[model samples]
Target chain A: MSTSRSSASSKSGARQSKVTVNSQWKAYLQHHRVTAKDSLIRLLKSPGSSIMTWLVLGIALSLPMTLFVSLENVKQLSRVWDQSSQISVYLKKGVVPRLAQGLSDEIQALPQVTSAYYISPELALKEFSAATGLSDVVEGLESNPLPGVISVVPSLASQDAKAMEKLQDQLMHFVQVESVQLDLLWVKRLYQFMELGQRMVWALALLLGLAVLLIIGNTIRLSIENRRDEILVVKLVGGTDAFVRRPFLYTGIWFGLGGGLIAWFLLSLGLYWLSGPVEQLIGLYGSEFVLSGLGVKDSLLLICDGVVLGWLGAWLAVSRHLARINP
Target chain B: MAHVRFDNVSKSYPGGHHALSGVNFEINQGEIAFLTGHSGAGKSTLLKLIMLMEKATQGQVLVDGVNLSRLGNSQIPYHRRRVGVVFQNHQLLFDRSVFENVALPLRISGYSSRDLERRVRAALDKVGLLKKEKQSPIELSGGEQQRIGIARAVVNKPSLILADEPTGNLDPTLSAEIMRLFEQFNDVGVSVLIASHDLPLIDRLDHRVIGLKDGRLLNERPAGGL
Candidate 1:
């Protein structure tokens, strides 16, 4: 009976301590909410200069972001160029049109050729004359100088430079063929330039990311200076560094979110302004191409970049300056 | 029992400017004492040692029998929670209201909203400022601000109250009233230590007075020891 009684009393004591610990955690969470709201409100109360900060951050973030979007568009254009890669196989001078037609069928049956069409010399001459607005000049010629040609669209896998070159060599070896020309090398060069553009975008994004961090750091440094006396008072009254730091960190978050929102606005405006004209131009080419804006993934990544930079800047500022102010 | 003991503690800055040298004193539980000295006589240093704001260069400083030197950085806040401090400047956060100023310590100690309100109200009532809860610190007179600082200090019901020249900016009537407030706290088992240079006023009270001169203790009297 005595042991049971003592155990009951100890349990009550343990329960009391547990209640206090729970309250401690709940109160800390409460303070976190209050400070977060307080900081956001504080920023809102002083929006003139902070709006300027957000504007500057937005412009800096949107520049590299716009460049990246443009690079992606160029990449997409190169992909369209990749689709039209074809090889032209010209017949020898004395080769008959029937022989050229048979050769075209044979080339179409090859693994690398998706499709091939035979064009007689008369038809080729007519197409050239019509394309150049020189029908009278072409009709006055004594004989058709164009060769019978087999136009072969390569399979998707054979569109690359090395594969197309090999395919051209194989076609040139045909008995009736005089020459083979692949229309893909220019697209390959364009793709290389697109890759270089992507690299430049990444480099510019990195430099601008540093710029965002410096802006946040300088802003936070000013915040710390403005609250110097308040910090000293807090230090005197038993406030922990974390307790003091919570609000400033919240301020940094507000700045980041505000900047992110502004950047999103700017990017959307630019895309909206360009999408109509771009679609009209694409329509004029008789092709169906749709302009895409910032998708979900890219938008989230941009906001994440802003938040991470904001946090890094605030952490740097608080650690450097808070220690100098003693009670 | 001795609640605070400074065992020959000495403190010096990096430039070898000695703030406190070989000081020893103690304040027992349920006692009130005055620490009087000139401007540079180490009163603030002694208080800083209790708050663990600065470490002693040599010897030991103890609060409620715990060696302060052994108190790690993580434990410093909890240590401070148990010691009330009222500064001479009455460092009330002017950005907040009087109620918020008094509620700071309770908020730090993790009091629930109900408990925080009750304790803050009780503290303000102790200083007869419960009606002025909604006013700003700037809206109040100097004496009122000082009382607000005291309310903040005692709101947590700390075992020890350390006042650093708390009445230095107050008039004579206001100073005595502040002393009475400290006396009331001491009457209820809380130990109070006030640092002041008002020698004439301190002599009028029966509380013990510890005197420091040139970073050294001249007298170390206990409560009721005259």
Candidate 2:
């Protein structure tokens, strides 16, 4: 009977300890809830200040994000252009059409050559006349000024700039070949310009990002100053720095989140506004390419960036100013 | 043991204005004392030292047996949890309701939700402002706001309570009522230190009065009855 009684007491003690642990957890959660509620209320109290912070952050975040998206678009276009780098080798003026066709076949036989096109001097002249709308002028000439040409479209694996240049040098060494032209200068210039633009965009984004941080930091500093008396009272009433800082941190997060949402909205509006004109211009070029705005992944990244910036700005403000406001 | 003590404590501002000079005093557990002086006499500075809001430029402040000067930044919060404080202007958050304002300490100390609700209601009841729990501090009168401050201070059941001119903004009748509240808390074994310039109120309270003059201890007088 004594053994049973002891065992029963042990069980009851275990239950009591379990209850105590549960109560402690409940208390901790309650404390966090109270802090969160207070923070939200504090942010909602001053709508003017909150809106001002959100707008400043939104504008700052949008500039970098928009530039990044444009850079990505340019990169995509360049990748497509880079893949189309091919070389055209023209034969000598006196070369016969049959000889040019034989030369084209011989070039195709080379391991590096993907495909070759044989165009006779007459056909080349005809194509030129049709394209340039100067058939009479060309017809009156004693002989066709154009030469027979072999257009070589390299394999996708050998389409790099260096590989194409090397192949052009090889074609120039051909006895019957007059000249080899790749005509990729415009594409190369476009690629280089895009690289420069990417760097400029990043530099501008960084400067503007710093400006955003300062704007947020200053706003939070002002907020702390305005609530100087309240902070003093809180500290006097046994409130810790963490307790005093919780609301301000939440305010910063809200500003960041709101700014992110606003930036995303503005970007979508800009894209929508520009879509009509962009489509019209594309139609004029007889192409079906459409201007793409931020995609799902990019949009999510933009929002996260905004929130991070907001949080960082708030952290700077709170850490610096909260120390100065003693009870 | 001394519930609160200041040993040779001095505070000098950046421009070299000494707020307190070589002040030494101790308040035993459950004692009630009034810290009295004119404006700029360092009464507030003394209270601040106990709260760990400001470090003494020289010497030590021990509260509940912990030397505050030796405490690290993170340890200050735990030390503050053991004390309650009321301010002159009440400094109640205007955005919060009276109940939420009074519940600040309890929330900081991390009470259970049910316990916080019960303790907050009890504190408001004790301050005779339970009916005003739903009202905002901005809507309450100065006296009511002061009561709310008192409620907030005592809600955590701290061992020591400090008041810096808590009744400075209230009229005579309200000030007397507030003093009575402090006295009641002392009767329940909480050490109380109040800084005030109201001689008549200190005289009526019959507690020990520590007087300060020009940042120095002038006199220590025990109330006539006590």
Top DockQ hit: 1
Candidate 2 C-alpha lDDT tens digits along B116-182? 7888998899999999999999998898888898898888777678999988978899999999999
Clashes of each: 0, 0
Q: Give the TM-score of candidate 1.
A: 0.85
TM-score of 2: 0.80
What's the TM-score of every candidate structure? Answer: 0.85, 0.80
Candidate 2 — what's its lDDT?
A: 0.81
Clash-forming residue pairs, model 1? none
- Stretches off by above 4 angstroms in model 2 are A1-59, A74-84, A89-150, A154-180, B14-16, B38-40, B169-173, B222-226
Interface RMSD of each: 9.3, 12.5
DockQ of 1: 0.25
